[model samples]
Target: MNFLTKSYLAYSHGEKTVSPWVILKPLGWLGSVIVGTRRAFYDHGVYASEEPPLPVISVGNLTTGGTNKTPFVEFIAEQLSRWGLKPGIVSRGYGGTTSEPVVVLNGRGDRSVVGDEPLLLSSRLTDVPVAVSSDRMADVAALLDHDVDIAVADDAFQHRRMVRDVDIVLVDATCPFGNGTSLPNGILRELPGSLSRAHAVVISKSDQTSPEALRRLKERISHWVPQERIFYSRLADPLWERWDGERFVPVGKNMTAFSLTVFSAIGNPHSFRNTVLKSGAAILHEFEFKDHHHYDANDLQKIEDAARKSGGKAICCTEKDIFNLPRGYVPRVPLYVPRISALVEEPGRFWNVVVQALRPQIVVASNGYGEDAIGARLARKAAQRFPQAEVCAFPLVGSGIPYKKIGVRILPPLSKSPTGGIIKYHLRDLYQEIKAGLFRQISRQLSAWNQLRSSCRTVLCVGDAYLLCHTLWGQGKKALMVATAKTKFISGHWKLESFLYRKGCRKVWTRDEETAVELRQNGVAAVFEGNPIMDLSCD
Candidate 1:
């Protein structure tokens, strides 16, 4: 282990010295705060998320790698394909120096150009399209171009920019949350509470840890995720493939005849070595490299020399390491690659939940930009609170740009006037709407709502009494209203508006408590849950 790795492992094991503690702890806290704030910005719709038309299932971990995300991604893609759905894989080409997206299916995947993980995915998943890019949105678009039914994103739990239909978070069974601190001091990318954003949590490599430790880990995870949403997984079904001078072919697991020299550049090298030993092969020499380390000529020379010295028949490595090997350099000894498949407990139940999330819908109804923001925020809450629901937006006024910004689906285009529906301040604005064919737009929107209302279980109206009246009229059901236009601090709701609130809406959330109190006095179910408009500023 290097100095950095030693220090990291020390911190992960709860060993802290005064000097490093002072420096790294504060940095970790700052990182946690930055991530937390950024997550809040995305959650409140201050930051826009790109939503692709096809369903996306993201496999990610809260920590910095070592949670078997890649294998689990492979598992998901294969499962999706088995179910007759065309699945594509998207990854951040971390090791390679690629400036743009390289689609493996397009034959643009050079190992040094697109990185090892993407190449490994491309080679392993025969027909699956693998797109690598630093920009995940670009990768999703690439997958869309390929006419893929679903996109399986690798290492994207913290990537709030792209909205995911299903978010699967992986936790390492041995060291799950990594001492409970953020990077530099520990391995956590975000706080453990962030697991609440995940639709499901998979405790990976479950067989590697003690049963008691696994139980404790699951108990701790249960604080954020429900017990039913938590699943256990282990690396199983190993296959050994030996290079026959040109390509690797599957050789049965009876490797006891040959003494092997093993080397790997992966998240968990110890696990790989354990797997090698379990194959009944004798390991004469061992080498370990940092995760995603690119092998150069010197690294290859050292490994070959060590194999020669140890009198090993073959030099063994993991499947991922094969892509990172120096190009055009062939090893004199036979190169053996061991591939492992992830086996999840109760996989049927897990996939059932993932498929079910694609069903239910939540419609956010709004009339203005401010109302759109409020509705978008509410949509985000509904998404997080109820991961199964597909949250979307229906703007009564101008095109729902704010909803689109936050990755909320805009039901249908609505006509816009020069005044943007602010007719109360000027009659000239109403004339602009009339000229813009507001009546025709209203008729189309009502027809669209009638078509959509039956599919949606919940509708959130985020405007004035006019919007509430329209939403209730269209849906033929009481909607949860966020009364953004009228407040007691400015001008309280009129008696007619109060009557509409009482009769039409299920609940009204006001901008201020005084407005809610006044509306409550008039027999309206009004609530003051702080001002959502104040969340408009990302700062």
Candidate 2:
């Protein structure tokens, strides 16, 4: 371990007292305050969180390092797929070199490009699509092309910008909470109280700790979350396979004479060692590297030298380490990779919670007062049509008063523009709105829609072409447009607007029959829905 990790572990475990305790304790307190305050922003609505259109399952941990997130994510994806749901995985690509979102199709992307965890997931779950990007919203948007019905986000506990339907947090059984302190002084990324945000808490590596200790940990965790939501899991099913210049093939334990030199670049190298030992193989020598370490020619050479000197018939490492190895560098010694899977207790109940979160959603969006009126009716119509699905509203112009009046839930509110979304009539107000951060509002609105609009079962856009543009920004599938702002008796829609309607919308509902007929002549799929906006005044 490095000096920082070593010191952190020592302090957290209460193993040693350091001279810098005076300095470290205060800093840890400060960190806790900052993290808590930031969370409060999201909790109290000071910051806006975007709700995903599709059901999103987030696997994250409160601790700084691995709590076996990748294995659990794999388990979730496999389960979702078995249940007939087209699931996709997204990661922040922590330790990757790429900036743009890279889709891992058929497990083809390089580990160096997409990061080790995502590449490993893609390789194992070949049928499941994986996307890696710093902006996870971009990753979700990219997955839409694959027709994914749901998404599983890896290591996204604190990524509250995009709200998850199901939040599954993993806690290490051996070190559930570090020394009861925050980071820099301990291992906790946040306070134990954050467990309240988690829909389910998983005690990972449950086999690593004694039953008595595990029970006590559960009691402490229950203070923050419900006891029924807590689940136990362990990494099980250890197998050894050898690389044959193409892929790993199952190898017998006797193939290496039961002696191996094990090396790994993972968060918990000791866990890997324990797994190897469980296979009844004696470890002759061991090489350990930092988590996600990139191995070069020199590193490989040293590992090979150690294997030969120890007289070990084979060199072994975890499956994740294979990706970090130098490309096409064949080792002189026989190389083996250990594959392990997570075994969760009461899997049926755990999966039931996940399945429940996969419920579909409908989003009603509008930009103006009259548009909001139409959107309110659409929201009611959607709620009546799909009673089992969630119905919500996204107001692009102001606080969704119309939706609020109708008792429909509204997304995070944005600041209203100076002209109240009527910039065309009062062009001078556009400059004033720009000064009031109109561009920023538009960007935020688009980002809000990108995930929620993209994953929603249906999108109802009520407004002019400008609102339609925002509606379609994140929606991969076509949307239903209720054009309330324009009419044929006045000035009709422009050619560009008609083209957008024909190409982007599945069907456009006009305020009057004349406008619908005019749009039909131009090959647009238009319908006269009888002015819902006029009915608003009658009510």
For each candidate, give its TM-score against the true structure: 0.70, 0.71
Cα TM-score of candidate 2 = 0.71
Best by lDDT: 2
Best by TM-score: 2
Per residue, candidate 1 scores C-alpha lDDT tens digits across 228-247 of 98999998858889864446
**How does each model score on lDDT?**
0.80, 0.81
lDDT of 2 by residue, 456-532 (tens): 55677888888776665544446678888788877888998898788667789888899999999999999986786
- Per-residue error (Å), model 1, residue 115: 0.8
Off by over 4 Å in 1: 1-4, 13-22, 106-108, 366-539
Candidate 2, residue 142: CA error in Å?
0.2
Superposed on all Cα atoms, the candidates' RMSDs to the truth, in angstroms, are 14.3, 9.4
* Model 1, TM vs. native: 0.70
